[model samples]
Target: MEFGEKIKELRTTNQMTQEKFALRLNVTRQAVSNWENNRNLPDLEMLILISTIFHISLDELILGGSTVNNMTEKLIKDGSETRRAKFNMITTLIGALFLFLGAAFFFIKAHSVEYIDSSGILHENFYLLPTGFFFIFIGIIIFLTTGITFVNSYIKSRR
Candidate 1:
């Protein structure tokens, strides 16, 4: 039940060729082969990406009763928890900021007056409403992703 074993099992279960799966994962075929053979472990981001692409939980990928799992959990509990917490906090703040900006734009559009000139075109400075909302949506996505990562890591560490 090591990471490599899990990868191989899932890959085979899905009936994906190494090349096809690697392409789907946006990695090299050799990387997939290496993973299946247990020659190397995927890095943090890769592990996350793989877990997401396969619809598998991160815990299922990283915690398979191997020494690496123990080390990874210890690293998270001892060293990386604070960083992850800080990251989640920062993404939340960013999301809030974007949301406020979007709201502000919406308020301006609702409350402001528009004037049309000789060309018969009206102008409103409230165009930023949609722009701000877009940023807010992106920020929220980041925030949620960071939060998910933090919670998953925390739970994995505890286990």
Candidate 2:
């Protein structure tokens, strides 16, 4: 049996109405209705709570049928999406930081002193220029890579 069907069986067998079950679970009636209808699922914590309230072991509650597969699929999908979002956010922040650093190094005037050796030849440092260019290069690469991936994913999703 599906999780929703199982939940309905348990609730009805216990002589509890949807509203009463929702009250027991501290959720809304609509939430219970949705669960019973397989529109969505509660989180893991809620699942555990449901098992406890139903006076069933977790295995009995979750493993009698295809509920295990359904719950596993949901968990995997949610985890994957969360990880992808975090990865995108972190990469974006890192790319922005690199760009800011590059701009600072390139545009901010360096205050290094010019040194004259015994030969009286003045030597100036230009390290900041190269460093800034490197930073900017890295930032652009990061942005382009991330943007392309995002666009590709968006296109695939649209299809």
lDDT top scorer: 2
Candidate 2 per-residue C-alpha lDDT over 72-127 given as tens digits, one digit per residue, 9 for 90 to 100: 56777788878878888889899999999998986663756678999999887678
lDDT of 1 at 71: 26
Which consecutive 10 residues in model 1 have the weakest lDDT in total? 66-75
lDDT of 1 by residue, 1-159 (tens): 566688888888888999998998899999999978877766678878888878887776777554565426544664566776777788788877877777777777778888898899987775677786787787778778877887887798689
| Minimal lDDT window, size 10, model 2 | 63-72
Candidate 2, 29: how far from true, in Å? 1.4
RMSD of each: 13.2, 2.6
Q: Which parts of model 2 are misplaced by more than 4 Å?
A: 57-68, 110-119
Per-candidate TM vs. native?
A: 0.46, 0.81
The segments of candidate 1 whose C-alpha lies over 4 angstroms from its true place after superposition are 1-77
lDDT of each: 0.76, 0.84
Write down the TM-score for model 1.
Answer: 0.46
